[model samples]
Target: MADTTNRLAGIAYLTVDGTNYMLAGDFAYSVSKVARETLMGQDRVHGYSEKPKQGSMSGSIRDAGGLSVASFNAMTNVTVTVELANGKTIIGRNMWTVGDLEVKTTEATFEVKWEGFSVEEA
Candidate 1:
């Protein structure tokens, strides 16, 4: 049987540089491999080849305590830990680099973007 659990319903949070930032409304974390393909000369059919390249993990967090803003302004690499609702955690090495920070006055919130490498589930 296939597992039909709604994992998204579980709470998700991120800890960056020892500061915990909870999801404000939405968040995204994805890893994609860069691929290159080569096509062979075709008699009747052609074959394709590909290779996987280094991938990255990126996402945004709701800047609750203004710590994320400070971190970004400092231009520092931080350790990241993502804790999911189902008790699984994704940990990243000290390679996380802070990116753009969006501030919305109407919503009274700040959104911080981060990217990192060497992430793994634990």
Candidate 2:
């Protein structure tokens, strides 16, 4: 039978250190490699080469005291975990924050993103 739990409920959360934060917006993650063409053939494309898989995640949290811009900036060698409603989880180790956090009088929220080694499903 097919699992349709995800269609019934939308729930995803981010865990940094030991704290969990419900994602304010959509939580997006990706694992990809940098592919390039190898030696070119005479007329057509030859082979291809690929680097290691790169993993990253981007999401926003409601402006709160759990994570401040200064605290997130000082993080290093951290583990990030994402839990989905479908009983799926992905983990990223040694990930660091590489974000473009901006503050405005109109709003207090800040954007967050993490990039590091390959993500592993757990």
lDDT of 2 by residue, 25-99 (tens): 777787664545587789987778766766887777666655566777776678889887777787888888886
Assess candidate 1 and give its lDDT.
0.59
Clashes of each: 0, 0
- Per-residue error for 113 in candidate 2, Å, reads 1.3
Q: Name the best candidate (by lDDT).
A: 2
TM-score of 1: 0.63
Clashing residue pairs found in predicted model 2:
none
lDDT of 1 by residue, 29-108 (tens): 54444456768675643766777643344554454554446656463466667787766777766554555567666654
Error of 1 at 27 (Å): 2.7
